[model samples]
Target: METQLSAARVSIRKGKAKPFWYGHPLVFSGAIQKVDGSPEAGECVDVLDQNGNRIGWGVFNPHSDYRVRLLCLAEENAPDYAIQDLVKRRLEEAVLVRRSLGLPSDETNAYRLFNSEGDRLSGLTIDCFGDVLVVASSALWVEKYRAEIEAAMRDVIKPRVIVWRQVNAPLRQDGVSEIIQTISEETVTVRELGVNYQVALGAGQKTGFYFDQRENRALIRSLAHGRSVLDVCCYTGGFALNAARGGATNVVAVDSSAPAIENAKANAALNGIEDVEFICADAIEAMQGAEGANLVVLDPPKLARTERDLHRAIPYYRELNKAALECLGTGGLLFTCSCSAAVSVDLFLEMLRDAAHDAHRRISLLKITRAAADHPLVPAFPEGDYLKCFLVAVA
Candidate 1:
């Protein structure tokens, strides 16, 4: 007795249902063998195995390489399920998890509220900045269900303002042309672990702040005592400020963005920190003369936007890390990071190793960390494991 999950059925190619069976949410166009009841984009459709057995359900998109992003497995797949309520339910679940982690507390009022695939909601990310919420929509389903999602967020997060944003590349990939914000607010000051930063509501970079590096900055603060530190691509002086607060004798931070440099300087003033120097310069050029610093941080922006650019982005990282290694001597520390989702942990570490070898430096990896706890990893979806960090002790 075979039961169809929905009116529109998408059958997986033979031998392609394994990944979906393991809870892998993405169903690419190539993996599908047949589609019945020609579902329109952003329509809720049931996914089936080659044998015509219902396996999962997800929203469909004809224009995307990822044709369907599975929202639930067969067990949870039921009759008359309100697809719109899934967004509300999943968002509430994400919020509950964040609350359990003590997010938006006295010390830290900013963090990632929803992490897309990591939270089982593909193409939607929510970052909280005090009372302001920034919603980054990167999928057709998210754009289609924007109203329902907003209602859910309001009930769950209760933010005073919400700003909608979409990465141009992702929007194109998802076949979503554009998205707009329902509300906006002025800049807000957010505190993270005793350090104060003035975040320009929708300016700077991704969601206006690097909350994924929260734990990493705190880790840098712990190890920066009495060291001369260089923070490259120092957006808003996150690592630099933490380094100065951590008793770094001298801090030189550099970024290509003039606005970022100005914001960093302002943040320095906000914290009454005068020891850190904010420089408006390209990261690679700035690092060439960044010697004498015992502690160096190389947190560059995303270089690999797509999988096709993986090979190209690797050489870039190799050169960047080599330059960073040149600034450090024996026993010096190098805190390097990559936020490219296309770059895997093994590949990133290998690139770091290649950089060290090319620089003629023997380094001991002290620790390897990823995005803070709020950004969880979904094993099946390795792309969810973006933001890889490495702590090295040069020898």
Candidate 2:
């Protein structure tokens, strides 16, 4: 642990310490009243309250609207440590939490090790795919101490390959350019609940696989016996394969990405799952075409990245879900989801109601679930719970 206190002191505006005290990590630029010292971009800063009382420690960024991402709070006296120590400490705690939850066990080797602010490491997410670890950083502070972060990961995980990827750099809001790329040598094969999958590592979407849906896939498998299943947006066929494994009478997986469809085919071949059909097509159109799937999985990508996107996104969600509901019969089941943090569970439920009305179908809500245990979220922070999965019984 580095023993030097940050040179800069940031004072929060009047009455703006409530959320900070409540463990919220975000402090927008508007909440700051003044800066006591000139701090460089991505520098650690001491956060003080309106009355100049020490609140905690946080990472500073001038270019971004988010002025500070709180590293940790000072319950008593502020700790004398650098950002590296905070990161490593969080990493160890996160690993212990996952281990307690039985992640990377015999049945599963792929999962989210650290979930952004959920694990209190704001703007940093690390997912483990077998021996490979994909580290995604969205904050400049993370980039400033990239070496320290990597070193901590090495010390904690000792992973075979660590692929660093940049995502949504807020510093690039100006005319500055942002380069987004991933470094991976080869695809890795991983297992989840006894199902084997060929993960495309960094090249695939959001670290190649959605391990957040691990428990949801298990639920699908348990309910898929003797059903005609349709998996839309089947990225590498996670749910589709699980459905087939669960003894689905007929399985059809569709995705717009040709590479994803090909990879899904490879995964099917890897598991000797010959009965599942893989299709590369538009998901909404495919859902409209398939009129009689008893079990349908509608797991689409993040539609509303931010709150501003809800207008355009709500219609898309409604249309997609309406099509999925239309594809189901009287006794059919529908597993729908929204990965957008901006779309709250209540809003998603309202959209589903509208969708069912549009599809002219009666729906009974069976269950509601979020991400798996490994992807734990802070209940105080609503955005931390990004995944909203709904299991509906169509009648």
lDDT of each: 0.86, 0.87
Off by over 4 Å in 1: 1-6, 77-81, 178-185
**RMSD of model 1, in Å?**
3.2
Q: Supply the global lDDT for candidate 2.
A: 0.87
User: Candidate 1 has what TM-score?
Assistant: 0.94
Which stretches of candidate 2 lie above 4 Å from their native place? Answer: 1-5, 76-81, 169-180
Best by TM-score: 2
Error of 1 at 353 (Å): 2.8
lDDT of each residue in 1-395, candidate 2, tens digit only:
45575558999999888888877888888999999888877778888899988878887788778888888888834354476777778999999999899887998988999998899878899999888898877778788788889889998899998888777544364112566677676688889899899876668777778888999999999999999999999988989999999989999999999999999999999999999999999998998889669999999998998999999999999999999999988999999999998999899999999999999999999999989999877765666888989999998
